[model samples]
Structure formats: C-alpha cells, structure tokens
Target chain A: MSEKIDRRMLLKATAAVLGAMPLAGCDLASQDPTVRGILDSAEELTEAAQRTLLSRQSLAREFPETAISKHFRANGSDNPDDGDYQRLARSGFADWRLDVGGLVDHPLRLSLTDLRAMPSRTQITRHDCVEGWSCIGKWTGVPLGGVLQQAGLKANARYIVFYCADTFGDSLDLPNKYYESIDLVDAFHPQTILAYDMNGKPLEVPYGAPLRVRVERQLGYKMAKYVMRIEAVESFGHIGGGRGSFWADRGYEWYAGI
Target chain B: MVRATHWIGVVCVTILLLSGLQIFNAHPALYLGMDSDFAHPAASIGVAQRGERKIGVTTVFGRSFDTTGLLGVSGRNDAAERAFPAWATLPGYQDLATGRRWHFFFAWLLVLDGLAYLVFSLASGHVWRDLIPPARQLRRIGASVLDHLRLRFPRGEEARSYNVLQRLSYLAVIFVIAPLLVLTGLTMSPALDAVFPFVAPLLGGRQTARTIHFICAFLLLGFALVHVAMVLLSGVWNNMRSMITGWYRIKPEGSLHVGEN
Candidate 1:
C-alpha cells in the first residue's frame, strides 16, 4: 500500500508542477517588453473605440425623489483656510476670479460675476461617490465647453486641468495632493459645466461656491470643487501620476467611467 | 480517514453553498443598520429604508452626494450607474457594504477551508497520489478531448479517482477562480487601495475587477453544477454515504465489500 501511495504521489507531483508551469510562463510572456507594448497599444485603441462607440449622452439610473438623504456628507475640505479663499468667502465670493490659461489662444481671467452672467445649463444628475454613496441634485452652471471656446483652446491642448483653492492633499493618500483633469472630449460633454448653484440655491462655501466642476460621466473623484484656475495641457507626464489627478496618483483610475 | 475526510469536505461545501446564497441574496436577513430608501431585491432593507418615506422612482439624493460638481467624473458629474428597474435600484453604498460583509465572511470560510484542506492533503500524501493525473493519462487523453470533456468516465477500477479534465478544472478553480474572486473584491474597496495601492491598477480598474469577479463566479457555478450532476448520476446513496461515514459500502453480485480510502 505504501509503495502504491508513493507511485501515486510522484505522478501527482509531476503533473501538478507541469500544469502550473505554463501559467507562470504566460505571466512572463505578459511582462515581455514587446508583449507589454502590444497590450498597452490595445488598451489605448480600446479606449479610443469606447469613446466613439457609445454616445456620451447615455442616461444613468435616477432614484426616487424621496431617496435623497437629508444630509449629504461633505466629502472633502468644506472651506479653504487659505487667506485668499478666506477673503473671498468673507466677501461672499463675489470677488473670486476663475483664471483660464495655459495652451490657450485667448487667456481669460473672469470674475465670478462674469461667469454667472454667461449662458448656463442646468442638469439633474446622480453623483456616484468613491465612498459608494450617491445623490441626485439640480446643478445650475455655465457650460464648460463655452468657457473653453471663450478662452480659445490652443491647437495642441489635449486636456484641461482644474486647480482648486482648497487643497484636499494628503488626506486621501499618503502624500498625493488633490487635483483633477479631463480631456477635450469630456470638456465638451453636454452635461459638463462650471457649477454655481446646487439643488436650488446659490453655491455655498462647502460646495465650491462661485464655481466648481460638473463632469457628469465619471465617478465622484474627478470633480474638482472650488473654482480658481484652469490649465490645458497636452500630456500629464510631469503631473502627480500621469493620470492627471491626485487620486489617480494614489491608484484611483483616472477614467472612472462607472 | 479518507472516507471521513471526504464526508467532511462534502458537509463543508454544502454549508458553504447555503450560506453563500443567503449572503449573496442578503434579503430577509434583516440585520440592524440595513435600511435603504431603495434596496436591491436580494435585500429587504437595501432598496428602501425600513420605514421608507416614498415609493417614487425618481429619488434624488441631495447635492452633496451628487458626484456632479463635487468630485465628479472627468470633472463632469459622472451620473453613470448601471440601469436597474425603478423599483429595484439602490444606493451603491448600502448595497456594497452589506453585500461585501456577507461576501467577505463567506469568502473567509472558503479560503480557510481550502487552505486547511491543502495542508491536510499535503501532510497525508493525498495531494501527490489521489489528486494528480498520470503520464499515461496524456496518452489516453489525446484523441477524444470533447468526449472526455463531456465527462464520459471509462468504467470500473480503470475509471481512476479523477480524469485529466477533472484535474484541469480543479486546478483552475483552486488557482484561478479563487484568486480572481479575492482580488476583484479587494479592488472595489476604496480603503483597501490605501494599504494595497496595487489592486486596481493590477486589475485594470474597479469596474474591470467587478467584471472579472462576475466571470469567476460563473465559472465556479459551472463547476459546482457539473460536480453535483456527476455525483448524482454515479450513485447518490453511495456517494452520500461515502462522504458521511468515510467507508463506501460496495455491494456487488450479492457480495459486500468495503473499499479502502
């Protein structure tokens, strides 16, 4: 019996080892530079296909009017402790200005009043959170594309970066700072806007009053609250993590298409 | 001891099947702190709060939770959630949390049991002998791959404990499916990324992980179905008794014999 068991064990060990070796080999194959390059190219092509394959106007799920929680938790910094932001808040954010520059034919530094006076688009959309909470609200804001067109995006500008007043840096990640960006396509999405009023009232300080982002296609982290500056760049190579956001640097996927 | 071990494995698998379904369903198991203004069907409290204030389909959570203008997608409010029936849609938070806890608990049980079995089998030499296929198996394996996959067990003592197909399937389930489930679940937890920042990037993204998890679950479900069918078709009472009492009572041609594990 022992001899028979020994024979069986030997055969089993050989088979098991042989069975697993190929998978490890496959892993090695994947790590090969040429293979890696091919895969990366496939991923890029897939992203491009995904862009034009589906209409950006697809509607997401909307919950009942009653599902709105009484208090939506303010996720990040409620107020900027920065002196400039504090002064603007003290003056009711009337003097806050949104500077649009970088790779733009026309750089514009417009006051909050000027932004508010521009033609606006209102949308009732759901906010999918990284923490998994979601809420729907009526947002009234100027279209982001109009602002970009007004500033006149430079021919080489491929993406727009939003720099906020309140720095939610180091809170979500070890040392990564909080910032967000969007490509030219999302910058022109119909639902995309520079919001000023939330629900039905003038935006409050905690809500990025005077101006904030309203990119309606991705998860919550891409929304850079607090209006201050917008920069358009061709590449994110020098940024926190090439993905163009602080959370992206901390392993959050930049294209949170959820 | 082998018969006893088989019986124990059977019992554990059965318990796992039942509890796993309950946890996945999450309905009718009213634990505290599980009230949704809108719960999933598998959840009584997930879709709607215990005392829901409204039944309308257009529930709007306030502006704060709205990803729009508040940490939204690509700076656009990512309003994208998978479509669900008006009555069935739920808050992604509540559903994910409770579903996760239940899923995690069962997952731990599966992992622990699987690990313990591995250790036991290794110590007992069962892994080397009983679980592995032979070299001659490759020779018999070549011509009719499809027939083997249909699981046409040859017959009698020549039947062997398991065939090449079974060996491949079991190995894949243990190595591939189990790890996929674990990694995908980890990818979804935002906090998990803080300590193990490699998860989402490794899996591509949170949504990508979710898609992979679903695929893995389907694979496991397929394995379970084939396993149950094979057991039932072979000899229900014999298989059941072998797992329950450890020694299979083989009665052939009016003679009774007990097979050694």
Candidate 2:
C-alpha cells in the first residue's frame, strides 16, 4: 500500500514537472541569443520559400464589392494624436505633404491633391491581420511604383520605407511615429498602393484618413497608415529601432506574408 | 528512422501545440467565412462583466456558456482574459511575437521530420507492411476493436504486426489528418494563398480553414492520448524498449507473461 502511494506521488510529481517545463523553458529559451536566432531563422526560411514559390506579379486574392466587410475593424493606431497630424486634420489635410526622398534621383513633396491627380488603381482586396482575422475592403489609390517611377528610384535603392503621422505609444514625440518598410519586390508589386479612399469614400480618420498603404500581399500591419513621407533606401539598417517597422522593432516579423 | 522521427515529431508537436494556443489567445475567436464577422463569431471566448463581477463567457455557434476559470477568464484573481489559460501556453504569458516564433520554427521542423518519415516509410515498405491492414484483417475490424476493448492484444507471431484498428488509426493520422493540418495551416498565409489560389476556396475559405485547423489540432491531441494510453495498457516496458531499442519481445502463444495483470 505504501509502495502504491509512493508510485502515485511520483506520477503526480512527473506530470506536474512536465506541465511546467514548456512554460519555463520557452521564456528562458527566448532570452537566449542562440535559441532566439534559431527561432528567428524560420522567418527567413518562410520568406525565402514564399519568394521562390510565388511569381513577382502574383496578386493577392481580390474580393468582389459585395464581399467587402460591412464593418472593417480599425486596428493599431486608428488616429494620429500628433500635433502636426491634428493641424493637418483640422484643415482637411490640404497642407499635408508626402515627402519623398532618400536614394532617389528626384526628391518630391507631393500634396494630397497632387497624389489624387496621379494615375490611380482601385482594388477590392482582403486585409489579413497577424492576429488571425481578415477583412475585405475596397481601396482606391495610386500604385506606389508610379510614384517611385516619377521620383526616379536610384539603382541602389532596395527598400521603400513609409513614415506615418500616427504615434503608436503615449509619447507625442516624432521618434514614436509609426513606420513600415518593404523591399523593392513588394514596393513595385502592382497591387501595392498608397490608398486615399476606402469603400468608395475618402478614407476616414479611424482608417488612416488622407493616406494609408495597401500592401495587399502582406498582413495588415505591413500596410502603414496615416502616411506622411516615403523614402527610398538601400537598407533600413539605421531606421527606427533598425527592424524595418514599428511592430517589427517590437519583435513582429518584418516579412509578415504569413 | 521511424523511432527517431517519431520522437522528434513528439517534441515538435508539443511546442507547436503550446505556442499555437498562445497565438490563438491573441484573437480568442473562430469564424466560418473568408473574413471574421466581428459581431458574429462562430466561437469566441470573452470576459463579460455582471455588475462588479467579471465572468468568462464562451460562445459556440450562438449559445453562451460560462466557462469561467478555464477558458476566457483564468489566472490568479481571474486577471487573465484569454481563451486558453497561461498554463496551457508556451512562455506562460501574452507574447504573441515570441509565440509565433516558437510556432513557426517547430512547424518547419515538424514538416521536415514528417517528410523524412514519409520518404523512409515508403522506401522501407513500412507503410504497406505495418500501417495498411490486409483485406482479411479489414474484414475483422469489429473483432479487432472488441479485442482492443477487452485489452487482449495480439501475442507471438500475431504481435509482430499491428492490428487492423491500429493500422487504420495510424494511417488516418499520418495521411489524412497531418496533411490536412499542414494544408490548412498554409491556407492561412496570405502569400501562399496568392500562389495556390484554390486552396482557401477549396477549404471553404481562410476563416473556415482556421476553424478546421483548430479542430484537427485537438483531434491530433486526442489521438496522442489514445496512443499513449494504449501503449501503457498493452505493455509499457516492452513498448518503450521496442521504440527505444527496436527489439520487441514476443511471447509464445498461450504462455503466461510477466506483468500480464
């Protein structure tokens, strides 16, 4: 009887340890540089596998107008609390300009009217969030490639970074402003656009009014909203937190195709 | 190859499951269509307030169930509002980024290990010889199930091969469920959807695929529990020895075996 009790105790102890192992190990492993590196390598493998399998011009699935979600949830920074953004918003963003520079032959500062005047593309596409939800919306905007072509992208330019007006944190500092970067492959993709219209209306403040990016092939977080500037750079090594985007700096995958 | 891959798969699946739960907690809801209809989730775990009290509510289809302390509301003082409790998740915290890292890394390893197993199993005729039951055995599936229920496992020469039920379950897990899990997982990737346009639609859409993925994960877990229980019931030491050393002692017919009780 004593032996049986001891065996039962042993079994319970083993089960308890086994149950707790993952919780403890995962936290410790994530902090270990080697383990973290090994884990982070999967992102690169996924990106490479996707790039190899997909053609450059392959388009994300576009939905019909009827398929568009009636209420699209605005995520992350829905409205810019920055003073400059508020000033621009008060004047209907007439004074807002998208400063395009960095590794470009021509530096252009284009106004909202200027962007609207450019050749535009309208696409009804699904926006997939990294949090596992998806929403379909109609976006009307100018293809990013057209603007890059107009700016005359330098031969060395490899990445296009977007600086947004919205600050993600409590601080109203410029350093906290939301930003995202994508490689030339995504930048020149036909569906990649700086959208100014959502669902047949001018983009609302809750949905990055005036301007937001629609990188259809990637997750919603990759699509920066409340666009303030566009930069063509060879590398984002010196950019905010050096991870290519606001979320990426906070440990989200830069290549959010998955 | 089978033993090595099996052990590796065990590790991968455990990490994947815990980390997957962590990721699931980020949303804590499931939908049926292509997109999430926020107002009408097919299933959701959320915390609802009743006056000064907080309650964990789980909605399935449209029916609400109070799954407090287990599902939506858990942790000390009921502070955590998550679908699955922290104990059930890797890192034991709300870090979606780290959870994703662990999930994808192990997911890749699992896929590679499965592929290796598949190639070796086919090359060695393991699939046909062990997993696929003969027509005669298939005909006696009901009898095999009865034998299993009675805890009467095969002995002597009969013990050299899997029974019909074992063969069928193994085949289903390997061919049907695992592959479905992989395909459904890939369907969630927007980039992959662009490459394989028909995958999402074929599966009834991305959100439906997500639901199916979650269901298939639980099914795999169920299979594991049954598999482990069977291993223990049949002969724990003998099974462990065979899996570890590839030497299973087959008792002679009608011979009394040690630890038979």
Residue-by-residue lDDT tens digits, candidate 2, A1-258? 997787568556755755656567778887788988899999999999999998999999988888999889999987777899999999998888999999999999999899999999999988899999989999999999999999999999999999998888754433577899999999999999999999999999989988999998889999999988999998997998888999888778999999
Residues A1-258, model 1: lDDT tens digits: 997787568556755644643423434533466643443343243345445544655433333455344455456778778787889888887788889999998999988779878999877655646544445666789999999999898899998998888766655434344578998878887778999988778988877777889877666778788868999999877775666886666534566552
lDDT by residue (B118-159, candidate 1, tens digit) is 777779987667667677775766643666556554455544
lDDT of 1: 0.58
Cα-based lDDT at residue A171, candidate 1: 50
Please state what fraction of the native interface contacts candidate 1 reproduces.
0.00
Query: Candidate 2, residues B5-68: lDDT per residue as tens digits?
Result: 9877987898998989999999989999899899999999999998987889999999999988
lDDT of 2 at B181: 92
- List of clashing residue pairs for candidate 2: none
Docking class of 1: incorrect
DockQ each: 0.02, 0.54
